[model samples]
Target: MDRFPEAFKRFEKVVAVEEIETFMQLRLAFGSWAGRKWVPTERQIEALNVEAARLRLEGAWRRETIVVRGKPHVRYRDVRTGRFIEKPF
Candidate 1:
């Protein structure tokens, strides 16, 4: 991200990384939104609800949810060893 985007700047273009990420999180947690209001998709909402319940009920939800990197980077945990690893997004 630190590297200068010369061509991008010349074209007056900007990426909405934060907004897209926010939308994804919101949608995953609450189905989807529409018309300035929340519109629930039954399957998606139900799946999310079920996963939440399972995680909480199984005591496997205490681990931190890492803020993953973007593009060619991936950041996450090593499940079996409980170690944090950084590869890319």
Candidate 2:
């Protein structure tokens, strides 16, 4: 049985789920006719992941860090309410 969606092969959902920055780049690339037909190389995916990590570390898209039961955790922010939330299931 497969856990990932069928679109995962094209990285359509994979990139977005793994990293927002990568999704943004993927979106941009798909905006063009030529780019839409292109498949990203593994190196490109790796680079996107690295860029996403760099942005997160720099707080560009600040995910809130919270301490729960003496353990530190990070979560995405709800832009509408400015609240941190657990991973969306």
Candidate 3:
């Protein structure tokens, strides 16, 4: 039995990349005004929560980077030849 799903599973709560980017900007903007005693508007708070949950789910599927010999390696693409190159230590 395949441990992975036979078909790609779509998230019911998928967030668009643009939305994520906008959420990040909003967070930064709010952070600058964090010292204010006034609470964020309900819509703003809801957006933040939604973004946070989406981020958590997205982060779970994120590819991890491993460092080797002080160099970060992911794919084996040659910078000069523009070809796939095997990793060489």
Q: Which ten residues in a row have the lowest lDDT in candidate 3?
A: 3-12
* Candidate 1 residue lDDT tens string, 20-85: 323235343332222333445543343333333333322111123444365353344433344665
State the C-alpha lDDT per candidate: 0.34, 0.43, 0.39
- Candidate 3's residue-wise lDDT over 1-89, tens digit each? 13111111122223233443343444544444443632566444444434444554221111225588999866433323445545422
Model 2 TM: 0.28
State TM-scores per candidate: 0.21, 0.28, 0.24
Candidate 1: give the clashing pairs: 73-88, 73-89, 74-88, 74-89
* Residue 48 shift from truth in candidate 1, angstroms: 0.3
Using TM-score as the measure, which candidate wins?
2
Best by lDDT: 2
**CA lDDT of 62 in candidate 2?**
30
Once superposed on the true structure, which residue ranges of model 3 sit more than 4 Å away at CA? 1-29, 33-39, 57-89
- For every model in order, what is the number of clashing pairs? 4, 0, 0
Ranking by TM-score: 2, 3, 1
Pairing residues by index, what is the TM-score of model 3? 0.24
Q: List the candidates ranked by lDDT, beginning with the highest.
A: 2, 3, 1
